[model samples]
Target: MRKTGAVPVISGAWALPNAPQFSEGIAKAKELCRSAGGTFAVLNVEGEDEQSQSVLETAFRDARSDEWKEFLADCLKFEAEIAKEISIEKFTFAELEEEEQSLERLRRWFRDLKKRDALQLPAAEQAQKALNSCIDSLEAYAQSVYSAQNGGE
Candidate 1:
C-alpha cells in the first residue's frame, strides 16, 4: 500500500528461513521513499521470532528522525499541489463551458480536502486515505468532463 506524509509501517508475517530478498524489499521501499522525499518503515513480525527478525528491524529503524518532518512537509505540499491542479482543471473556461455536471464533484473534493485538513487526519494512514479519496474524486470529475466532451456515457 502507498503512504503519504509519514513513515509507512509495514507489518506482515512470513515463514522463517527467508532469503535476503525480503530485507531487500524493505530497503528498496526506504530508498524509494527517500527519492520521493518521504520515509518508510518495515516492521517484520513473525510471531515472536525475535532472533530472526532483528537484522531487518534494526536496518529499517535506523532512519534519521530529522528526515521525517521534512518528508511530511514535502508530502503535504505535494497534496496541496494536487488539490490546486484539480481546482485549475475543474474551473477552467473550457471545462466550465463544457461539462457542468462535474462541477459538484470537484467542489466536493476541494471541500472534503479542506475539511480533513482542518480536522487533522491524526495518522499517516488516515491522511493517505484522505489523499486517495481526493484523487478518486478528481479522477471521477475528469472522467465526467471527458465523457461529456466526447458524448460518451
Candidate 2:
C-alpha cells in the first residue's frame, strides 16, 4: 500500500521460518513513515498459526493515538505537498486545465461515492464474492500456465 502521513503498524507472525520476511516488512513500513515524517510501530504476534481480532484493533488504536491529533497533523502536512498527493481522493488530476480538472475530480469522487454506496447493497456484496472467486480462479490458472511453461521447474 502507498504510504501516507498516518502512523504505520506492521502486525504479523514473526516465526523463525519467516522472520526475515517479517523483519523486512517492518523495515519497509518504518522507512515509509520516516520518509513521510511520521512515526512507525509494530504488533509482533507471538503464534505463527494463532490470530485474533484484537491485533487489528491494537494496531489501529496505536496509529490513531493522541485523539488523532498527530495523525491529522501529519495528513494535513503531507497533503499540502503537491507532488505527494496520489492517494484516493488525493489525485490532483495532474496537468489538466482548471475547468476540466474540477469536473474530472468531482466525477471521480462521485463515482467512488456511488461505488461505496453500492457496496452497502446485497447485490453488490454477492457480485463482490463472485468477482473474488473469478479472480482466484484466474490466478490459479495463470500460475498453472507459468509452471507448465517453466517445464515444472
Model 2 spans with C-alpha error above 4 angstroms: 1-119
Q: What Cα-based lDDT does every candidate model obtain?
A: 0.44, 0.38
Candidate 1 per-residue lDDT over residues 16-132, each given as its tens digit: 123343454456667987899886555444636876567544433333223333434544654564466466654443653433334344444434333323213334344455546
Q: Number of the top candidate by TM-score? A: 1
Error of 2 at 17 (Å): 52
| Location of the lowest summed lDDT over 10 successive residues in candidate 2 | 12-21
Worst 10 residues of 1 by lDDT: 1-10
Return the TM-score for candidate 1, rounded to 2 decimals: 0.29
| Error of model 2, residue 31, in angstroms | 41
lDDT of 1: 0.44
lDDT per residue as tens, model 2, 1-153: 212212233342221112332354457767877899986555454544335545544443443343234323433342233223222223222322332343344334333322323113343333334334433433444454455556666
